[model samples]
Target chain A: MRAVAALCLVIGLAVPALGWAQEDKPAEFPEKLEIGISTDEIAISSDFRGADLTIFGAIEGYDPSLLAQSKYDIVVALEGPKDNNTVRVKERIFGIWVNRRSMTFELVPESYSLSSTRDVETIAAPPVLNGVGVGIQHIRLSPVGYLGDGSNLTEFRDAFRRLKESGGFYQRDPGGVQFISASLFKATVKLPANVPNGTHVVRAHLFRDGVFIAEKALPLRVMKTGIEQMISNAAYNQSFAYGAFSVMLAVLTGWLASVVFRKD
Target chain B: MNIFIILGMGAAVGFLSGMFGVGGGFLITPLLIFYNIPPVVAVATGANQVVASSISGALSHFRRGTLDVKLGTVLLVGGLAGATVGIWIFSLLRSLGQLDLVISLLYVVLLGTVGTLMLLESIRALRRAAANQPVSLRRPGQHNWVHRLPLKMRFKKSKIYLSVIPVVGLGFGIGILTSIMGVGGGFIMVPAMIYLLRIPTNVVVGTSLFQIIFVTAYTTVVQATTNYSVDIVLAFILMVAGVIGAQYGVRVGQKLRGEQLRALLALLVLAVGARLAVDLVVTPEDIYSIVSEGVYR
Candidate 1:
């Protein structure tokens, strides 16, 4: 009985220690990967059935070279989980440029896939630059130039339309991944007025040879304003409610002060 | 304008709101209008700045133990309800497509009347003070009707006996107006507390601020969720400047006599009123439509 009790105690402690030990082991990347994007969440899974490698872990950090390097392959596939469950994927061998100040992404590459999904719209691939191979698709990525040269309203509108058409811009949609083709340009995505005020997930993925090598998800939060726009409309647009209230208060106070202190 | 310029304007309005007890709506809305921002967007954005400035002021007042929790709570409860109703009314008007013209006309009339009244009152006070006449005092029996109302209660700060029903009714009414008008409602509440409730001047400021904090905070949360109008970045920048300015204003406010402060505030109101009056008579440079595509639209 004493031996059995000692054995049970040893097993109990050993089980937890074994768990700790296993947890300390480093993770490995899988050979094949499937990435999914939904309205609320993002999921990345490795294809164990077809691959020998294992995904050890996922890390996210600022990479300035992401927009410039073309030696490795990077592809982003967006699969919707609701309703139609449509799948759209884009693959490219590109360099990356990171705007550290503005947290922007720019992709530069000698070639890029114009259409990765069967049904989704695609942009016409730009011609490859000199010295780069002429065969595949080439896209220049510059965050600053992605928008345009000027802050004029027309320029801004055109830039927005182009970015939407290019399928390489960061936009708040039902779901999608932002990819870049060249490191030559830079742009900023201004938050639209219609965006819901709440927390959102921003995922950055690194791919090579049609598979994700690394993926990272960051958290973004939106906050509230204290007054309703309708109230403002009523006050400023409809009736000087703020001014009227101020005057009423001033008059009441002035009258009361005169009466109480007998100053008038 | 550029992002930096927008941010700078927000900071400037926030500082002014902190320095003066008045809400920055008068300044911010006009400035935005002048800059060609739609009235709705201007009001919404200005409210965002007001929340920041009021928060900074409220926190300091709370720290000083000047805030009256009970009074503020009553006011907030009524105010929030009223604001909801006001928003509904505003939407109704908007759907009818007459919101802008109505609002502008109201602004003109209200400002003109208020400004003229204040100027005249201040002059009268000055003349009376110079004549060495005895100041008017409230008759002991004057507030008998207030006592007759249901839910009678005593507010120690204001040191007057009044019914809770009147207080709440006044709060709700003012709240509705405030929500409809997009004003802080501080101006209304201060007077109600002083004359109707007979609260003392010292307690009035703190109590009004307490109620404003709750009302504005609610406004911010609701506006953000429903309309996504709140910009955290903008609010943060304005609050930093506003809090610093508020501290200085409070010190300066403490040194001035109540009569002097009232007179100055009256003059400021009148000046703003006159400006609005002029805007009413003179045709707007741009009388374009105020509609825009956004979540609300």
Candidate 2:
């Protein structure tokens, strides 16, 4: 009797899966979403080192019956301010290194932190990710003014990505996003100490069967505050005054040291 | 970089600065390069730190009334002009992606030449001492090509009468080196003053420190404003530790005689130069590298 009941359960599970497979119909996306950052504004002080950015959110409107069926995979990416960048490749030319080729990429973010529940390749097809611009590799690279073959240009683009990735600007963690419950997910992104101060965009994407069904985005501000803020502002905005101040401070320090450590 | 690393490097460099009377940029720059700080940032920040130490040393001399203010002023003028031009060239090299190569080559040449000369001179002095031969500290000033220039001036403090053109030219040359190499130019400045200008040893130290003050300050300001590469926090950390390290280094310097000290400093200088030279001759692990224009944002 137990065996018969087990068979019935198996058939019951397979039938619905088969029916859904045969349906060949598109699935509904998330009905609603809610998201937030650990802090709306990040204030970097003089002693600022680095911080972890916790991005958490909850999804809604998924079938209640399939709650335990691994319903969705989430990807959260924090894209810092975007700007144009030039990537140069150096070649060893007769005992010296020189830049031989160069390419410019528009729409490159100053910093990018990406997190996903699974490896991005497993999350979706390359075409799908490329179309949606899901990963660092998927970042749009439209060379503005360059004279190079398409294949060679791609190498330069790859080199840019590689270099940035090593520099802590471009980051990704496959298992960074954790599913807390049936509908809630969270991710932790590392904010580097040298993170550029600006308005950053945080995006949370939900995927099912390698298809992007829904996503949400929020703005987070990384800024300098307190005396550090004033100094940083002066350094860039009122650069001359800042430079003069730095020089003066050095001189004063030197003067003080001389007085303190004078040989009697 | 880790705080510990910065602190450690600062301390090590400071000790050297105090002992050898070098600006420590010679030591600091190569170490920073090893730690992977961008060469541009290293050079700019190195100048920023050097300004502080030079000021401290210069002030002590000023108090002793050993510093030649008149001579310092003249050098300062030439330094200012040279610093501006050097900064212009630095920017040009940065754009061409040749800044690192140029700076490294400069280090190799400067360190190699200076270290070898110091080593030979110190060894000769050591032999004279061991052979029980009387060692004359200073040779009488002799007429040289430098004396033929125009604008003659008498520096009572240094007790020398020389052409202002050569003084200005020397200062200008050192200033150009300061901006590019991020040093106070003390290592070269002292030697130039003693050997070329034939300045008295007592006046040379104070005067070199005096001139270093203005040149490095100008370099720091220009680098901060034009390049925006000066990391004030990094500079402060280096300065504080450097100042302290210099104190300890002073104590160590007192124990070593002049010949031994110069010989050791020369060996250290040559070692660093050799390491840099090897990097050029040997194939790099990765020939391809990337650099972003402007502050990396």
Candidate 3:
């Protein structure tokens, strides 16, 4: 009788499991994150000043109890294209300040702007943030060569972060992310006036109860337009032609000036 | 960054260059550095500006039958070779993070020496004028150690048979300066041609200008291709303003006594050198800095 009862219970559970599998529905705890940008491309002109970029996102399959308790947190970051960055520290040598030591960080973002619901440190543990590499302070900055004794690693990293922050290439807005509704959020990140042109990425991370749950990323292209950009492009892409043209222009200008100002 | 400021700066430097018979590249590069433009950009763009400034002077000399084409061509050959070597050194220093320091140090030495010499010469000239003494000219026929060198070349335009070795050497040295310091090197080249090589004073300015146009033009092209530091817009604005200002400056210069103009120019050069020296000795605002590797794109 006990075996029959056990068999009946197993079949009952199997039927619901089969039904759930057929419906292709995930468990309630598996919340999903989705983000959208109004435009995937940003056009920068000669007169471009720093401006704000807004990103909209929604959380799917969120728990009602967790939402009521304000357990959900969102952090969105817009990271510029990555390149090798070198940081140098100057020391006094022979009454002159000179660059004495330099460390190059491999594959780091040229520019980074972060927006979060609250202070990133308060929202999650330091280890969690570091693991996710979400915050500017938490981003990975691995040095490009051998580091002896691992000493001065922190010093160089701190200096690099400080310089980038001071130069306005790296920025953060702790309160820039806000929840318009229970499941939707809006985040605003800054685009510096000197923002690099390349394929940037807009990354959105959702954390629940101090635990990271869902993350989404979308590519954003930053393009420079107008004559300035055209000139820059020519300089890099068709450098030889551009160089010849510059020489020609200078020659013409000089010849014209002499002709016009001839006293003979 | 400000167009008006740049235009004004260009005009002021142009006025001084016109008055002193200079290319103005030295003044432009340092002034740009002070205005917060990167030293690399300033150096490259200054070379471009020199090309424009020199072309007109060279052209005028050509029409006046003062320029020595054969000598200028020989100098150009050496200048091109030297520029290639200079660009290599520029890239090396840049990668080592010492390019700015080296540039500043070189300017300090060049400007300091040139300024002091000019001041001393001008003071002597003023004293002589005050005493109603006759102006003494150096004998052109006097032989120097430079004449002993082999591979002599006849430059009929200057009416002198000179060693190609010294001419090419001088051109090479000036070429290096043109690439690294962003100066047409006329200030040094003119004096060297007059005193060292004993070239005829009548043709020295024209020949130097001819060589300067080609050397600076070559430097501009190479800098654009290798460093991508030549700013065309900045160069154009500076050229336009500079040419306009040079016209007025020539008229004003004609009204001034030679010694007085030299004294004023000496003071200006000394002031710029002193400023650079102070920046080097004094404590900087920040010691830590960062450079992003790769192109902006």
| Candidate whose DockQ is highest | 3
lDDT of 1 by residue, B126-232 (tens): 77788987778764335646667877666664565567777777667766655445456676677767777666666677777666655555555444444444444
Best by TM-score: 3
Give the residue spans of candidate 2 off by over 4 A: A1-76, A94-100, A114-131, A166-168, A171-196, A203-217, A224-234, B2-8, B136-140, B153-161, B281-290, B293-297
Cα lDDT computed for each candidate against the true fold = 0.43, 0.78, 0.87
- What is the per-residue lDDT of model 3 for residues B38-81, given as tens digits with 9 covering 90 to 100? 89989999999888888889998999999999999988888888
Question: What does candidate 3's lDDT look like per residue over A1-264, in tens digits?
Answer: 010000001111222222322233234557777677766777787777888888887777679899989899999999999999898889999899899998999999999999999999889999989988889889999999955787998999999899889999999999999988777788888988888999999988888989877677878898888888999999888878877788888898889989999999
DockQ of all candidate complexes: 0.02, 0.37, 0.59
Candidate 3: pairs in clash: none
* Candidate that scores best on lDDT: 3
Candidate 3 wrong stretches, greater than 4 Å: A1-29, B295-297
lDDT of 2 by residue, A133-241 (tens): 8789887777877666687877877888888898888899899988776677778776766677788888777777777766667787877666766766777787777
